[model samples]
Target: MRDEWNAPWGSIPELVRWAAVRYADTEAVVDCGGRVRVTYAGLGARVERAAAACLAQGVRPGDRVGIWAPNSLDWITAALGAVSAGAVLVPLNTRFKGAEAADVLRRSGARLLFVTGTFLGTSYVASLRRAAGEGDAAGPLPGLPALRAAVVLSEDAPRSFLTWKDFLASGEGVAAEVVRSVRVPGTAASDIVFTSGTTGRPKGALITHAQSLRAYDTWAELAGLRRGDRYLIVNPFFHTFGYKAGVLACLTRGATMIPQPVFGAETALANVAAERVTVLPGPPTLFESLLDHPARRDHDLSSLRLVVTGAAVVPLSLVERLRADLGVETVLTAYGLSEASGFVTMCRRGDPPEVVAATSGRAIPGVEVRVVSPDGTGLPPGSPGEVLVRGFNVMRGYYEDPAATAEVLAPDGWLRTGDVGVLDAAGNLRITDRLKDMYIVGGFNAYPAEIERLLAAHPDVAEVAVVGVPDPRLGETGKAYVVRRPGSSLTADDLIAWSRREMANFKVPRWVEFVPDLPRNATGKVVKGDLREASGP
Candidate 1:
């Protein structure tokens, strides 16, 4: 029998081609800055040009190509093009510093990098150059020996980088036939997304084209996404939520994608009024800001039809406010991770505010979810335990790290999702907490281990342990329990300032406590429980 859950498109390139042919004149994407717009046909052509450019740059099948840029029209074209040309796309978080991004490129062995020249008043190319150092005029840069080229996406490229226009221009020498013939199998790795590991680094999760298409097809349906819907995507593109759920979902349904590089209440409200955006999805903090904005009622927001929020607890009042105040018809909450292709469960449209706010809803079709005990047995209903997932949506494996992959992905295809949740009798999942020590700062994952590593680099920080503490605005923010070195008079403010420059904004600690020593247990591990209690209200 034929599979009912199989996606109509076999691969990412195939999906774009199908959309171009089916909706040639339909607007596919619009830059929120009013800089560029493209129809389905136009997007298809640009993607092919990008693919041809990759071919010209010698990107081979199975090779990794990295994009270290924020949400932009070129980000979409470059990422799709790289994957279309049979190279695995590695999306580096735009919030990362040069050192952080270089770590991913080095680990992924990416040979080419597409970076933004300037964004949010910082020159990323310059930061990268500094990170690479001026080498001894010969030996490889610190950790990026595999990266051979840097293409800057900007009006004026830096002296050391290739301009976006020039990068595309290089494709002129490569024939269209050659680009079209470079096809990756549906099951082949399309992207290697890096998520924070407890080991003070990040692990690459290998995802396939078919997995992405199938998973988001279900996501779009449950979220009430449809043809001609104007989707204002505020989520960062490096995440699976934006790249797969936001961008690919739009492509699958013929929705017009409007990428918002920055999330601000006034800015998002302005775009909604101007673009008549029907679909808006973000973290609860986004909606809270929009609702609490001083000019909340100033804009004509009647065009909004659907609102989806997650990555933290969804306030019932927020859902009610969107419907009562903003006149939004549907507001939903979802639960997923990068390992699950960014899709697992979603609160269906029209679900009651209580259910929508309280639970993560049931698993999508073709995916099985269970709450298992520590010994690997299924837990009874209403009992919270580790959530385990088994389905096509699960990632192939942690890229090139079988040992790490084995810890999570079982031999029988079940994935050990390090999240604690209870499955009600109705199959709805109410997320209680996390099995892993990860905190959500405005929908961004701030792994304690990752933050601790960066803090340990501080000159005055002799010892440090990071933990998540409650925050009214960001759901949870990091609090660093630090022990200063002898004779070192480093203040909490000093470490906070240092963190701002050393790591991503979300991962930076919001609070710091200077203690003489860390409380430890018999096992010699720092007692995080004591730290959390000490960081009390």
Candidate 2:
């Protein structure tokens, strides 16, 4: 996986080892939720132990390893360990159901899985076991034929699954020098971030070590992240922004991480005041909630120095409020997607409030962004068209889906971002519409096709279509138009309840309308434009 462009300290293990020496005494990670703190030296030691555990469990280079957990010290150690063992990291959505998690694990042929015991009241282990317990695979989860082992990240585990303690203890026998000399994931696919495409199938975007490091190094630089800055990471670790911009960026700049598994304005304020958090980056809703929170004035939010927000259109008033109301030093907005290695454009620090609020700033270094017509011709500035990108930051391709890969990525190194945006005369990019009908719910990309696919499985749903509708809190949420089967009396409440149990929370449609039939165009395609109009502004 090594490449000429791969940095010596690019990979997780390499970064851990290097940071351990450079910032040994500096606070690295403080899990306020768990009441745990780990310095760089401690992170390095723990990661090394986890990597040894990975080897002891028979993980090999190029093997698919999955982590299904929330933001925590255990999640970081487990994911870094898998990569340190030369395994491709596959982070599962914490909001995912057992079925969805198993679907990815099975498709990726994950050899090992690290799962949390329980989170937000549901037992993740119980959910996964029930979902994957009936298959012919002789492993811990019988349904997953390729999964050889499951490590529970808690004190207790089923007899079949290995506890986190036992898993690490097995690696104690492995020589330290051997672990040090072990393979470092370089230019190879360090991770396969799974994203649902317009076709309703999950596609894994392959990003290499060099690409991630180079891009985020450029990101941390552009974002003006500095050493000793305490960052409160509210973004889920599964997304590229969280893993790369949140974790990787901190490592690059020696910033301390304060991971929050679930977001609550009250909790966030407490952390900012107590931990002296100086850096905060998240979706616009994060800032909005914090500003509107009843107890906001109770906490000493004066320590907040920076905020980077995007994934939805940022309001000019919101930007003004963050600066004026909160007295924040700097605020910026940016845009990205999974196919583009989770980054493409960002606002510069000194940009005016109008530019920062109006558009996702110019492309990061080494990347070319274009507004093109349907015929593939470039458009003039201010003319909206499909957004296209090309650069070292682009992903290798969608893992094992060359056809889908070919659909977006051209042979000459261009990636069709499937987003409609306008380029300002100054080269700033402002995204307008999602060409694939995808929407953002609290910074998570939700494809309508994916949600429709999930809904279509219901026995009562004879036909279904989903569209993004504006929401005050979450930015945007799904609204489903469904047709019931003959004589079926499935109510919206019933379907919504079923969806909560079946799909991730973000994908569950917040609004459901029982329609006679979906409006179709001349080509028999559901005209989403009419649906959005009917949904109202």
All models, RMSD in angstroms: 1.8, 2.2
Candidate 1 to native Cα RMSD, angstroms:
1.8
> Can you write out model 1's per-residue Cα lDDT over 204-229, one digit (the tens) per residue?
99999889888888888888789999
Which residue segments of model 1 deviate by more than 4 Å? 1-3, 135-143
Off by over 4 Å in 2: 1-8, 134-137
Instruction: Provide the clashing-pair count of each candidate structure.
Output: 0, 0
Writing each residue's lDDT as its tens digit, candidate 2 over 292-397 gives 9999999989989899999999999999999998889899988888888899999998999999999999988788999999999999999999999999888999
Please estimate how well model 1 matches the true structure, expressed as its whole-model Cα lDDT.
0.88
What C-alpha lDDT, on a 0 to 100 scale, does residue 225 get in candidate 2?
A: 93
